[model samples]
Target: MDLRHFRYFVAVAEALSFARAARNLNMSQPPLSKRIADLETELGVRLFDRTSKKVNLTTAGEAFLPKARDAVRAFDAALRTARLLSPSHSRRLRIALPAETSRNVLSDIVSRLQQERVQVHLVEASTADQQDLLTAGEIDIGVIRLPVEKQGLWASASLGQPLGVVMAAEHPLATVAKLRLCDLDPYTLVIFQRRFAPGLYDEVLDLCRAGGYVPHRILHATRMTKALLRTESAVAIVAERLAKRSGEAGSKEFIWKPLEGSPLHWWSSVICRANECVGLTRVAVDVILASLQQHEGWVPMPRSVRAQSEDIRPIEQRVDSVNAH
Candidate 1:
């Protein structure tokens, strides 16, 4: 079996559906099925046990999956090493960070790295994509939203964002010194897309509901501007930094206050392959952390790190959040 077989096998193994794997690989289901069949025939063992309703890995498949993933990652690392040897890219470092990271903080990270003769191959990806890219060796280090499974990776201390309400200065609850989740009951909620950080997204809504926050509706927006819109009738759930920025931008049109119980929060961390956090990779993480703390006003921890719900929230909640704002 060649690299193509490994790639196809890994895709199918991760997705667990021939149809979904084919779509992800930009191929067809029939050909994908044939490739797996060819792989199994060559190995004299079956990898997946397929049923009409679901797909599963055989014992042999389960045993081989890690090795397969390692091979793919090794190949990718080799290519990156080869490219890094070139004079122009000798100090180039590949890293991906979350979308919500401040532009000024990003600029500071880039500037600091440049002073060390390191060039950043920065990719701004969604929270879901950071870990996948890091695991696949597509990036040397990744800054991802926290509370993710960190089984085989090196992670930094999580930096938490104090959660708050951002609303037009004229909104009914804007003048409150501190707000509770229940205070947002009457207005729609403006929040980020769930695909960015599934756990965090669900936890926000679940915690809100559990704390007696029953919004008239929920709205999700991929863009900051849209999420910040309709503030007269919406209460945007945001980090303190974002709230402050909005408040500054609107020329006193917006106000932000911490939650009364301070239960809501967001966290992020800098991560790299457990064994690969050295030299420039280490520098990148340091610069990011320092920049975030000093330039972006993010805290090392939230005022209150309440226990988060282990279970994901219902799908209908996500659907409503996505359908509006």
Candidate 2:
């Protein structure tokens, strides 16, 4: 059986529904069903037991599922290795990043790599979804928030930044030295949607709950800009970097204060599928780690480093100012 057959088989086994598998594979149900039938015929075993109500894997199918998955994974790994070793092949490194990560950080990394003549492509996505893509070999590396719990992935926590509570400049809390969880219970709270920032969202809820009150009102937003704009009569807890940028953009409407007694921090890192490092991937990882180390403990880089790198300068400057305060 070819890789395509294995792919079809794995899809069917995972979904357990021909229709759903076909939809995911971007093919019609009849053709997908026929491929599965052919696979079973070749193997001399019934992989799936079809029923009027549902489809279920047989014992043989169950036993073969993991093997099938491993086969597909191995083929992908081999293909990647071949491409990596072939000088004639265009070496394109694919990186996935979270949407909340500062554009400046991304731009800086890209700029440095481009200057070094590294061929790369970046995919922006949520941390959780990006991890999945990495696992499936859809991407080579991922720069995402820390605390990811996926198995077979390597992650490093490079640095952490404090989260800040942002409010309209005219809001009473804006004058406070530090904002407490209790202080925000009285106001509506705008938060990142669960899918985009599950860990952060859950942490915020847990912290608020421990303070003896649930947030009075909750508004969900997918994007930071949307969340900030929707903060009518509400307070937003966002990354310090985000708050600073928003404030500078004449959020003359808003002010931000460090959260008091909150363990809220933004952690960033570079992650990849475990043990899958190749030449380009290794170089990319090394560069990212080196950059992080060079800028460590300073909260941001000095003006020289920032000026030397156009993409990263703005973020570095903002981070430096925040740390200076």
Candidate 3:
């Protein structure tokens, strides 16, 4: 079978629904079903047990899945290696990005890479997942959230912005110009998930306590606070610049306002395996730095040895003054 068939099977197996898999694969459900049927016929075994209520992988399917993934990975690795050795091959770079990464930052990076004649493949993942992928040699670069594990990795934070409050447009507090920690105490608030951003989540909670204000109630959002904002009247905390730059600014259903006193910030960084910083990874890092330097509030990491989340405090002092508007 071809890589296309492998991809189709993987997508269906992961989703456990032909309709969902078809949507993800950008194809009609009927054709996807036919492909699966043809594959089953070829293998002389049913891969998935189709039921009216749900779809599930058979024992045979489970046995084949991991091998299929390895096959795909090996093929891709071989193709990339061939391209690296070929003089006429165009340059390609794979970058892992968190789902909530800023659109402006991604746009700028893509723009710069295009100008440099490099093809970019962006993989959406969490900060932790991206780190794992980077460590495994699956991706050349990762632009992920801060507080990532730094062992065996070279990482630098370049973007930092004050946290903002997100609320439904109809919420009374949405009309307010700016909000203080105490102002949000009366409403239920949604914080970014601790698993996804433990440092930022704790920082926000600590800031509220320092102000002597505890929220009436608090909840957690999975990947982005924007989804919570759409359905809940409760406020969500997120980076103001990211909300605007990511096109959430145009949403008539939600509004984001800068926090008063500006005590908390969201940070992003570029990370890769420490020892593999030659060739494409090195070039990707330079491209990231150049793109970040052009932005107004982005702070370029120091050129010295790699720094961690603790090192960001000093940089915050300098950037806070500039971003306090």
Candidate 4:
């Protein structure tokens, strides 16, 4: 009927002696005997055959023994699992990001968290999809690009490396120290589809329009490397870190260059729900912002746009500290 009753029943069932079961349970023989008598009465079955010298289990007691053991085991297992999954027990953060962004920054964040014994579940999706997942509660925080205008969402200052262009090594533009969007007008271009990278893709299109040429025969690919390898005539623009990882040879042949215009950079920020802000998110954001500051030549996002995300509130007034790092 109760957990204590089950425990008492198991002890008596195993030992086959009221005196031994009471001693094991640290209770007196009289109380233990009475409790077992009450349980048998409640169940409407006899549990033991007792004589002055010996005690043995009745058929009803034997039948209930395995069931009682199973109940105790199941309850204990459920308790253990709940403890393991508790936020305090795990101390891990569940984060989501676009694959490209994760490739650039997630590893470093994970390594830092590991030192603190915090585990991180890093899930990868397209930039837009990651945002949707973040909103849907599928992930706690997301690494996403700038100019994200969703309400109830907040973003930290740019976390890690900025985005750069990837072009084939043999391309004439690769010869330049740095290339601009204007410089790529003569060549066809390959880029991530608008669905995956609406903000960055639109920026590229706008820059091309300013240069007076539309991107010709633009090929859409889900993955950046696929877009690069599939297009021989078109130069693929990709994140700088991805360019470095893709290599110059093998399936994809490409080169990388920094866009020439002043402050020509694509950026990523850590995003989370404004209302859900908590200690873990703050700790993670601090670690990432610190890493960003340590790297040379990294700049914070502009004040106007940065002010929109709740994540910047704490760090906004501390600009000197951010830049000094």
Clashing residue pairs in candidate 3 are: none
Q: What CA RMSD would you report for each candidate?
A: 8.5, 8.7, 8.4, 19.2
Encode model 4's per-residue lDDT on 156-264: one tens digit a residue.
6563345456666666776888676767677777767787757657765765677554676677764555445435556766556566555633334566676665334
| Predicted model with the maximum lDDT | 1
Model 4 whole-model lDDT (C-alpha atoms): 0.64
Off by over 4 Å in 3: 1-90, 102-108, 114-117, 170-172, 175-178, 222-232, 245-253, 293-297, 300-325
For each candidate, give its TM-score against the true structure: 0.75, 0.69, 0.59, 0.58
Please give the lDDT score at residue 274 for candidate 4: 66
Give model 4's TM-score versus the native structure.
0.58
Shift in Å, residue 240, candidate 3: 2.3
lDDT score at residue 294, model 4, on the 0-100 scale: 50
Write the residue-wise lDDT of candidate 3 on 1-325 in tens digits. 5677777888799889999899766699998998898888888998999999899999999998998777766776676567557664447788887775556668877877777778888888777567656544578788766644446566654566567777888888877787777887777788756766565566668778777558777777645566666665678777766566656655787777887887666667667655555665566776775565455366644322333444333222222121101
lDDT of 1 by residue, 1-325 (tens): 7988998999999999999889767698998899999999999999999999999999999998999989887887797668657786558888787876778978887888888888788898876777667666678777776556534577666677768777776778877876888878888887777867776787788889988897777777646544355543687777777756645334577667779878787776677776666666777777877787787776675323342222111101111110100
Ranking by TM-score: 1, 2, 3, 4
Writing each residue's lDDT as its tens digit, candidate 2 over 69-127 gives: 99998988887678657774345678886765555656666776776567778888887
TM-score winner among the candidates? 1
**Candidate 4: misplaced stretches above 4 Å?**
1-90, 101-104, 159-164, 174-178, 222-231, 249-253, 291-299, 303-325
Spell out the clash pairs found in candidate 1. Answer: none
lDDT of each: 0.73, 0.67, 0.69, 0.64
- Collision pairs in model 2: 169-254, 251-254
